[model samples]
Target chain A: MALSLAQASDVVDAALLKARELGLRPLVITVLDPGGHPVVIKREDGAGILRPQISHAKAWGCLGTGSGGAAGARHATRDPAFFAALAAISEGRIASSRGGALIRDKEGNLIGSIGVSGDRPENDEAVAVAGVESADLVADVG
Target chain B: MALSLAQASDVVDAALLKARELGLRPLVITVLDPGGHPVVIKREDGAGILRPQISHAKAWGCLGTGSGGAAGARHATRDPAFFAALAAISEGRIASSRGGALIRDKEGNLIGSIGVSGDRPENDEAVAVAGVESADLVADVG
Candidate 1:
């Protein structure tokens, strides 16, 4: 795992802290390694039952497309057929939204990504960015 | 919804602490609410690629059988066909192993469960017991 658990934990912690500051709804946050496997996941007590899967899907989109969820949303709009096919291929594990971003190191290397759910898309994206920056890494929100 | 993220986080922390003390292989620990939904999951950096799913499966067995994973193993041994059918029914999400236990409050009420993967089943179960106790809960290993 190129992305250590400590780093992934930090990302999730920062994201949760940001969510608290913004007074957003409870969230489920997931951090995925570059290989698209989950490293850490934390769901707030009141998060919807499905938020965990949604969180994973948001990040899965970024991993599969080499683009952030925002970019995924754009692609979905520009190529709806392709994006729909992707959803079917991944068995509904990819989604287009604003709550996901690729984590990049100082050297511009992809390490992982963070995905958040349970708030407005923009707020979710904001929290994800906070997480990456808190770890001293760049967030490629695409 | 009876399990809070704090409790689940503590379970993962204590399990990891136990794993470190034993010098065991890296592990993936999963805490699932009684409803069989994941509340927290942590995969160590060097844990096997399939550990997350295995951890979840171990916990799922506990939730589905209304008994600990050890009981599931016993049932598997006593009635292989029944257990095999169970595995097929859940789409391979239920497993018989020693690393899963139902978590109960001091009053013997069910709360959630903790599952661990990476080391031998006994070692994994030991770490899970440590985690449940650390959270001031009892381990119902069945």
Candidate 2:
């Protein structure tokens, strides 16, 4: 399903709210389209300066591979060589790590992805998940 | 006091090395000229797919503003009016934040910049500083 810009923005806002509710420090969050282009982004005050770039890169990784965090996990796992090449080719707009997640619509169609940075990997993932669920989208955890 | 390509490459090498030494996993490191043009880059295997883009954008922010991390820190300060315009004007490429450092010669000449991502912001910034020092250049921290 085609992802609306509104949905993307909502997802990001929800994620930011959840982060605040949890008393987590600020974060940089980004949502990318299916083609790996940025759709929306938010940066919390007191978050690091590099967060927006990092978050966009992570979301790009998810969109580029269409596989979400699994792709980042693999880069951290079995495929170091290929991952490096991918980084070079993409010109540094992608990051495969624990901070990214895929966004899908209610019909189980891929919509886009959300990426978060400025925290622990697991915490980043949690914020993204919370953000998606808050937007009322089915964030496929599996 | 232009940074020679060799020096820039060395900066990238040292940044990547430091990232590994810190057990921060693989990273994508990039060095750019004062013009925000890339001079050299090195991506560690398994660094994630979008690292290169993030690195480039981070470097671009430094080059564009010529202030290293000042732009990033400004946004993180959360003056919403300024950040909103920044985000709009940057076309999603301007990311003013930590993890980037302006490269200057001993005489305080603006030469280039160093940027790192794919790890924590603190780790990323540390590696970037190491890179600038490795090239015998001053980091624009002040």
Write candidate 2's Cα lDDT for A16-74 as tens digits. Answer: 88888888878999987766777888899999988899898777777654467755676
Give a tens-digit lDDT track for model 1, residues B48-104.
889999999998889898999888888889999998899899999898888999999
> What ranges in model 1 sit over 4 Å off?
none
Model 2 regions more than 4 Å off: A1-142
TM-score of each: 0.98, 0.54
Cα lDDT, model 1, residue A56: 95
**What is the number of residue pairs that collide in model 2?**
17
Q: Which candidate gets the maximum TM-score versus the true structure?
A: 1
Error of 1 at A38 (Å): 0.9
As a whole number from 0 to 100, the lDDT of residue A106 in candidate 2 is 83
User: What TM-score does structure 1 among the candidates reach?
Assistant: 0.98
lDDT by residue for model 1 (A1-142), tens: 2678999999899989999999999999999999989899999988898999999999888988899888888888999998779889999989888899999899989999888999999999999999989999989989
All DockQ scores:
0.90, 0.04
